[model samples]
Target: MRRHRYAKIVATVGPATNTPEMLKALFLAGVDTFRLNFSHGVQADHAKVHASIRALEKEVGRPIGILQDLQGPKIRVGTVRDGRLDLTSGERVRFVLEGSEGGKDAIPLHHPEIFAAVVPGQDLLIDDGRVRVRVVGVEAAVIEAEVITAGVISNRKGVNLPGTLLDLSPLTEKDRADLAFGLELGVDWVALSFVQKPSDVIEARGLIGDKAGIMTKVEKPQALDRIEDIIRLSDAVMVARGDLGVEIPHEDVPARQKELIRACRLAVKPVIVATQMLDSMVNAPAPTRAEASDVATAIYDGADAVMLSAESATGRYPVEAVSMMDRIIRSVEGHKLYHSIIAALEPGEEETPPHAVATATATLAEAIHATAIVAYTESGTTAARVARKRPAVPILALTPNVDTSRRLSLLWGAHSVRTDDVDSYEEMTAKACHHAQEEGFAKPNDIVVTAAGIPFHTTGNTNNIRLIQI
Candidate 1:
């Protein structure tokens, strides 16, 4: 089915959307990719879901991307005494590095990295900021903090430090096992959470090693300091706004989201705007106007894709959520201001033959009113370069490798097709025209601009463009 929009939809799979029939409905509803959140399910459970997705892909004969999202290391307080404690504002509390149960007088925090990184005056948000405290003193084994916000603190509540950077690996021991399992399952993408620095991506790269594309999760406030380096190292980036909103001020998230999207676009990498996109749809068949506007805002900001987390994974209306997101993207893309807004944010191109040719391909397609922009790529970079432009024309990306096609599923405007590689210009044009027409993107006498390297099968050589009349 052809979606009349550019931005793609990534749906998460869980109990609600795990059946093969439901998966097929989601795909037909316009889900280009599926995310397996390792935080919830065990390996055995995820294996079955992955198998079902593959079966659906075969049934539909369309490439579908699978993302293995690793649940990275988490920082939390140890067990509380009597299960929970009620606090009052201005009350002083003591935290010690221990593993035992805690009382009002003494709370246990097992992570030593937090002690090493935190200093006086930094705030610690517990349970997603329901309980807040300011660090008043730090010692070798204990920390004294003053309660700023009073709420019930439960056992094993998560800890968040907005200003301090902790010295810890983003990957937990469980993530290592999960990454190995997912890689063995032939997943196309791996999303690394709890990332705070570029070295975190480097560590993941050491393990991933070209097995799958790495999508860095920008969830920490400290990561914004060096987002450029992180974006450069990552194959893609996700605006994980859940923890991000907790770690930073709530009002700053919109600007931060725009900055991240623009940075990713400039780097010619796919960026997914994620977290609570359609929260109300998790229970209701329809979304609130504000939620609908939120999805449209991301599309207007030129996000490569928008993700549905719990809305699809565990929602009462999983298929409806995906369909609504599709409708929102189409509505926004058809809006009068979307084109100019994206054009205004068009990134400066690299001064090279490959990049210049990609830019010219988009321009020529617009000038000639081409039905589509066909990109013949081996590594998906050529298609990425063309997509960075956010042109008015749609993209038909043809690759010899199914992996490439699957990876392109997350790319904006990319209608991926896996076929035999074309070795010459004549073959490139014929194949491009055939796929464009067959895929319903063009008809005879319609213009389609095709871009490829002179020597076929050579990667990163986007140095040629041809305007073919279908």
Candidate 2:
């Protein structure tokens, strides 16, 4: 099937919409991509869903992308004795790492690394910030906190330390195993959640090899600190506002989200703005006006995709939510400024080394009135950077890996093709021209711009630009 012209809709899969019929209905409802959250589904269940999606793809006679979202190292309080706790304002509470053998007033924290990082005066948010506590004292295995605000605390409540940097690796054992399973299942994309540094992307890539594209979830404050490096390493990015709002000040999330989106655009990497875009539609048939505007703003900001979590996964109005998001994207793209905003966000000469080369190729394509710009990239970064320029002509990205090809389908104006990896820049350019001709993207005597690296050492090292005729 032809890809969506504007922003794509990524609908998550869940219990409410896990069957084959519901999956087919969602695809027909305009879901461009399916996100399988590994956090909730087991491997066996995912295998069943994968089979169903493949069957649907054959039925529709089109390629559909499957994104496996890995649940990274999530910190949560251990089991509570009574299954709940109620704290009043100013009440003193103690959290202990007692190896899951704690009493009624205490909860076990299984993560010793997080326990070691706790200090006095640090804030700990529980249950997605439904309750708040201020650490007042610390002992060997226990930390005492004074209730800053009182609320109901339930079992397995999520914990977030905004300013406190936990001494933990981004990937846990569970994430690594999940990633292996996803790659074995031939997932197109593997989204790493709670990405804090560039190393996280590197680790995930090492584990998944080239079997799947690695997408970093930017929801931690530390991720923003290392945004450029993370963007450079990641194939795509997801603006996960749910935990991001908890990690940073609530009022700052909006501006931060915009900044991340713009940064990804400059890098030419496909970015997805996710979490609660149409949350009310989970129960209600329609979203609030503010939610509509929110989806529109993401498209206006040049995001490659907008995501629906619960709205489509377990919502009563799953199809309607996807349809509404599609409409919102179309309306926003109709604005003249939308194109201009994308063009203006392109990386300039001073941005980064690879970005400079990508900009030059895009500029050459425009100046020569090229019919197509072909980028030979193994990592898909160069293709993404060129697509970010939003050149009027189409972009043909040639890759040897199927995962790279599928991932690039999310980018604007990019059509990916799988071919043999080239060892030299000359061969890369020649193959680009050949494919552009064969694919009918470029006609005889039509100008095409080709870009690649000198020795072609790495997939992301785009350093050469040449203008050629098909």
Q: Encode model 1's per-residue lDDT on 215-298: one tens digit a residue.
A: 999999989999999999999999999999999999999999999999999999999999999999999999999999999999
lDDT of 2: 0.82
Model 2, residue pairs in steric clash:
268-384
Error of 1 at 56 (Å): 0.7
Question: lDDT (CA) for every model shown?
Answer: 0.93, 0.82
Residue range 1-470, candidate 2, lDDT tens digits: 44445567899999888899999988888776799999997999998998899899779754578999988889998877677777889988888877664543476777777678878988999988878999998888888889997997777889998877777777788887887788888899989988878887887788877677788999888888889999989878999999999878889988987898888876667899999999999999999999999998887777888999999888999989988888788777777777777677654444677878988898888888898888888867888778777776678888886666767767766777878988875676679778998777877888899978767757678788888876
Best by lDDT: 1
